[model samples]
Target: MTLDARSLIKAYFAEGTLPGLPDGHFIGGRIVANSDGDRLESYDPGNGQAFARFGAGKGEDVSRAVEAAQQGLAAWRDTPPATRCQVLNRAAALIRERSDYFAVVEAVDSGKTLAEARGDARSCIRLFEYYAGIADKLEGRSIPLGSGLTSWTEREPVGITAQIIPWNYPSSTFVRGVAPALAAGCAVVAKPAETTPFTALLLAQWLHEAGVPAGAVNVVTGLGSDAGAPLVRHPSIAHVTFTGSVATGVGVMQAVAPNVTQLTLELGGKSPLVALADCDVDKAVEGALWAIFSNAGQICSAGSRLVVERSIHAEMMEKLVARTRTLKLGHGLKDPDVGAINSRQHLDRIARHVEAARGRGCSILTGGSATHDPASNSGWFFEPTIIDNLAPSDPAIQQEIFGPVLSVQVVDGEEEALAMANATEFALVAGIYTGDIGKALRLARSIDAGQVTINDYWAGGIEVPFGGNRKSGFGREKGIEGIDAYVRTKAITIRH
Candidate 1:
């Protein structure tokens, strides 16, 4: 019999006595049920079906996980760097071995295409492997002091770290934060987004199989207000790393303030993609499509604002609208070009933005509504939308829509394009596409984003640093800088 998404899902679940759902938080070493015995159902964004349930982590659960992390920190901190590298490498291997299963779970949980979910799994593996290679290389420096005195600095783990992951890219986001913390010899209390916690639970099992010490990495699943708030406020948590909206990130920062907890925030962005008249129009169009429509445009650094030179603005708009119309929309399991939005609430949010843009007299060039497939009628799907004739100050142009929506703005020249790109408060990412290498490089420099792509979007691999500037929040992830976020420096002095 031929295999479809439903068949594949059923077969995967039927193959073994895998980790059961309605899981409690992964504390100390094993799955521990919530003390209050509360449960939260996880829905499939592809069909709006509740496929699994998990114990809703609460303040009590956060406390228990924190206690476990606090108790386990010493052993993890004392573990040799070589051994830590070995463990992280093993975890990477395990993730690769179960890549198919993890990919399916991520697709079913997050509504991203199976291919995208597989990419997420691969990214998770690469993150661990990258951190493993660098685990032993986190060296300190020798400082020059008086002639008779010798001084040196050493990097050490910052104790228990609390990571609050978002649902957009659950598996990769979870590992991206946890791997570096573990590599840096810090215990982690990870809280995956409640909407997509299953893969995180499965990842916890893989970590255990990879010989991670119990309590060294824990998974807590619950609402942000309930479990996340308490974890951020918990005095025992040494550091906090959060990825979400600006409002919630602010709440996290505020909660951690009483204790002055060290923190890293990767908030939202209204990234810009500029297409110059000198660029290959086809290549620019492709880059713009991938930049905005990948993962249904839910990425934090998605190039949602399209700025094209006035000379080629009309041609570029026609090309973008035509290409967007050809994109297939369906459930993620089917590997459609555009998959369902992450959830009902998110779909509603996107709808509100589109409606507001229309109300403001912004022209909807094409696709300003939702579409549904008969096979997955319950899915929360939004059409790929292109809006034009909006001022730079328009809310739809300035705010983070976090959906498959692209706002096009015409500019007279490169200088004006750069000005419009940086006009927003967000400075997470920006992209420039031009055949003139010198002009591309110059435009890249002029853009005020933490990460800039020239002639392409998302140009770098996992080895490069990624974060944001201005309102996009601080602290870097995904490079040597990622590791530094989990560590602190101490100076040692010796007198002869």
Candidate 2:
């Protein structure tokens, strides 16, 4: 049976309401509605229709959650690593069993297609499984001291953690930090992005079912100011992991400063994609599309800035435009090539960027307007836009539009291309496409981004460290290095 907008809508409503914080925050292994009775409504971005209403958690709610996490931590800190591994593995199995349902919920909540949502669900399961596999392997070393003295170092949990996940890829992002922290024997008070909290709440339930002790994992849902700020400011929170825009990340840093908290931030990016004349134009085009167009270009590490050698610039642009035109746009459930923007506000922001670019005399090669499917006339949508005749320093190029807008710049040669690609204030992920492997590797080494891909857009796997440099923010997530963020080193010395 095909799942389209109407059918999904019917299924969603037939259940009476969307599945999420039906009562309130998930705290101490139970759902607790806010005492103040504040609430927020969640909408389906594919259409401007309200689907679910949940408690808008406040500072008091966050405080309660933190207290719960502290109590839970006291209990969980003594849990054997082997037991934690077993619980995480069980959670991973449960997530895999209900992957389809979670995917549907994600698609409705975040305005991403079913295909993308399913991929995120799978990634979430993998993260839990990966952390589970590594739980028992968090080994410490013994350092030999002179004479009868003995010394050793051990990795210990950083205590209760405050995990702030972004709206995009909510399920996967939630697990990315939470899994490692749990494996490290730390309890967590997670704040899911206000716009998309359904899957996170559901996951919390699954965690409890998987045998995670009461208060070990909690979800507090509300506006950032109401719930998020207080959670960050809580004195008991020993660590924080945030994923979002740079501006917001700075705010998080400020909030956590008073507590002297350990932090890991995955901020925004204005990544570049460099296509040399010697590269395969077909592969470059494919990579470019996957990098920027996937997820409606809302990705932080999107390859929005396309730097091409002047010789093949015209040919590349032609192919990019032709392929972009063929992309289908519709509600996420319909599985269109492109889906609605996350919200009306975000859709307008994309338009403003395009208009600003046009005002500066940049040429719009194909699309630069809001569009909609006849089936769902109320959704927020934007055309896949390609802007040319813009310099590398153009606002449209320098800033993160966070939409399906690609800025094209032609360069004289390799040096110019490198200079242009590295000119951004943000450095997260960059890509280089060239037939010369030696040249590609050389350029990759010089790129200012944290992760560079050659001939492809996204490099590495779930086990590879992923983060950024400069204004893109600090610290890393994923791989073995990712788990390190949740742990602290303690050296013990004994005199015998």
Candidate 3:
């Protein structure tokens, strides 16, 4: 059931439109038109013009996707582990070969710069390859037994699992969840974020082409209420892996409470980038700039809060502000250093936070307002902003402003800097820049984040486990630890 996906992918990017896009759900190993005739138009974030219309899945469609997954679970779960791993390898190869095509479409679809989108596509490929190695190694342990008794364990799939994705970095996030789930032999019902379903659907199709059984991979796209909620609440779903806002994660928890289904949530964060007095100013400046500005600062683990020691604060601020002002903003297709925000609403959200900071008498060191492309004058764009003032309680410092904005807060010493870093309720990932190994280790251990880095912001990839601490959400994703949520252990014993 291989699709002419290459042609479809090529056609859209070539023409800069989606009229030829598959306007349907990818179910039962192929494209499926919606049960109802309702459709929703997707806009190009670069220009804010409607580019394509896709099917709007309702509750019934969600049921259909679940049913399809249930039908395929047995065969997929029972397949030899080596064969399963091979299929994953093949899928990764396919994506890697067409990586450029994916990059262009991702940039256009998600309003990310071409360079950023390429990194995301590459992340997806590497994640698939990393998970493929673990498929055949899901082994259990033999227990010590006395005399005539023998005991051991077996890891078994948890039937149908639902993976709800987020719009930002959709391609990478989709593979992050699904690759591990599939490697563990679980059939999946995937709900890509409504606005960014293109890459996920195309990736699912490639999985099918790589020998996944029809229905083993399903994607239902539409509004969250219509498709995502129903999929989350679907009683038959054995496990759920969701990535989004904390408020929505709570709703998902309440929905799955009655079923007692297992859940893994990766909620957003207001993560910190702490620079100590001993840290290299150049490295700290570069790390801070990248940690907040990449992906237009839409990443859940973005270093939105910059906590700096008072002694080096002014010097570091001068250097950071100098570089940040030089960043170029334009359409994603143009591969600018910074691209458009995902939507007008998101632009407004970024603006409100900046305006609130100004109202609080914070010094707007650089950008502090929403502006359009200086050339086209169209699209949702926000100037890269840096706000500096007092108070750890400022909303701009405390909240996850998923935009290209950095709140630079000055702290007295190491203790105050670390205190401010952990003051926020959200603890996902944090970065501490310092020259002292002892100090780095101490701060890394003291930070409340699930993962911490010294001198670098994003130092790890698919190899290390990542998640969050406290309100940032929990359950690890990536690495071998990621597959645990998709399977259950069964103990067996024999007595003679």
| Weakest lDDT window of 10 consecutive positions for candidate 3 | 1-10
Global lDDT of each candidate: 0.88, 0.88, 0.89
* TM-scores of all candidate predictions against the true structure: 0.96, 0.97, 0.97
* lDDT measured at residue 61 in model 1 versus the true structure, 0 to 100: 89
Candidate 3: TM-score? 0.97
Tens digit per residue, CA lDDT, model 1, 334-404: 76898888889999999999998888788999988866744747688898999985788899888999999
Considering summed lDDT, which 10 consecutive residues are worst modelled in model 1? 13-22
Q: In candidate 3, which residue ranges exceed 4 Å CA deviation?
A: 1-14, 18-20
Off by over 4 Å in 2: 1-10, 13-21
Angstrom error of the Cα, residue 362, model 3: value is 1.4
- In order, how many clashes per candidate? 1, 0, 0
lDDT per residue, candidate 3, 1-496, as tens digits?
2223355446655775854356899889889999898998877788888787788999999999989998879779999999999999999999888777777778878889988988998899899899899999999999989999999999998889999999898899999989998999999999988778888888999999999999999999999999999998999999999999999999999999999999999998999999999999999999999999998899999999899999998899899999999999988877599998988888898898888888878888999888887778888889988988557888887888899999888998888888999998999999999999998988899989999988989999899999997889999999889999998999999997
